[model samples]
Target chain A: MMNIPEDISPWLAIPVVLLLIGGSLITLIGTLGLLRLPHFYQRIHGPAISITFGAGSFLLASMLYFTVLQQRLVIHELLITAFVMLTAPVTAMLLMRTAVYRDLRNGRQSPDLKPPTPPASGHATTAGANSPGLMEETRDRNPE
Target chain B: MKLLVEIALYFSQFCIVLAMLLCMLRLLKGPTAQDRVLALDTLWICAMLFALLLGISFASLVYFEWAMLIALTGFVSSVALAKFLMRGEIIE
Candidate 1:
């Protein structure tokens, strides 16, 4: 194994350790919320929290640690950070839409839920009001 | 001192794997599509972190590239899944 010097200064280690610990704790909280939240819509919020901060912290830690060890700019971690920030919310939005479509199709009332208005002509029609499978199919076709 | 850092890295990896397992359980038990999607998203993030830890442990650049690729592909898949959920079609 090629030896990379273990020369990280205490100043750097402080933030690296803090980032790792904080990221882990946030992810744990998100998972707990996923398990404990009462409804799908509510539970979706849990992992969102994790991806935003949990992934962000770890990425930051990686950047800091590698930069110190290598004595140069370590920027690749940014790619992961950028990817997570952009994608997590989009995924959440799509899933929420799918869940809503399912609820509507089943006539399963979501308290405080407003009905979806009919789509304009050329927009895909909602499957028969009672068909969950068709609704799921529609969700699959339209990944926006 | 090197040994201590290795221990810390290993401990962090352990916690990450535990979180990944919990996320998997949610994925399997999810009552709604949204819950499953969320779990899957969490799983990808965990995987990326795991890859990074591996890179650190091995002191290799190769794992970092793999991690980036995982992050990229995971994003695309989740987006596709979400879009399908939204409009019932991925490409149309």
Candidate 2:
């Protein structure tokens, strides 16, 4: 609900409009994928797309729009793009591993996953179990 | 041009909000912990985009910082949630 400024020119408006519309549509499509996809593995791809393409488009548009409005380069938003690019993959990997680990613990062994050979020094038990007292359990299991 | 940009910005804002709503639905009814976490992460992205859209419409520089802050905290939270789910503890 922003009031449009009287000074913004068509040259600036054209790309900004296109980029904004495109980014929002991309975001909507991605979130729809997250909601409608039947399987979690398939669902993961949805947010991954938003994180990359959607973020890129929005940030680029912001940079373009602001640079025009202020008549100076405004690119601080690029840092957000960098931060997202670095952190999203790590979080997605961890979540996927958690799902796989929970599946293994519940005895749903798929053919593709070999039960991880126990790490030296009781690593698997503590990591494999979802319990509050896991730190104590790890210590008790590993005496050296 | 002014009218066109204004309408585009409004439409974009609406789309991002709707996307956030969809993400909220996933977060509420997701079948598994990982599913909920993924939904939450997607919600964070939607929120960040919302902020960027706001910045464009308002023609201000401050929303950029807000977007950056949201991105930072969201990243930390998503990573922490994923780690907690994976390791059974946050710090260990």
TM-score of each model, in listed order? 0.78, 0.83
Best-performing candidate as measured by TM-score: 2
DockQ of each: 0.40, 0.52
**TM-score of model number 1:** 0.78
**Which run of 10 residues does model 2 chain A get worst, by summed lDDT?**
A135-144
| Shift in Å, residue A116, candidate 1 | 15
Report how far off residue A26 is in candidate 2 (Å): 0.6
Model 2 chain B: ten consecutive residues of lowest lDDT: B52-61
**How does residue B18 of candidate 2 score in lDDT?**
94
lDDT of each residue in A85-122, candidate 2, tens digit only: 99888888888888777654543332133343454555
- Top candidate when judged by lDDT against the true structure: 2
Off by over 4 Å in 2: A1-3, A110-144
Candidate 1 lDDT by residue in tens digits, A32-122? 7887777777888888777888878877887887887778999888877776787777777777777777655644444233433444442
- The candidate maximizing DockQ is 2
Per-prediction TM-score, chain B alone: 0.96, 0.97
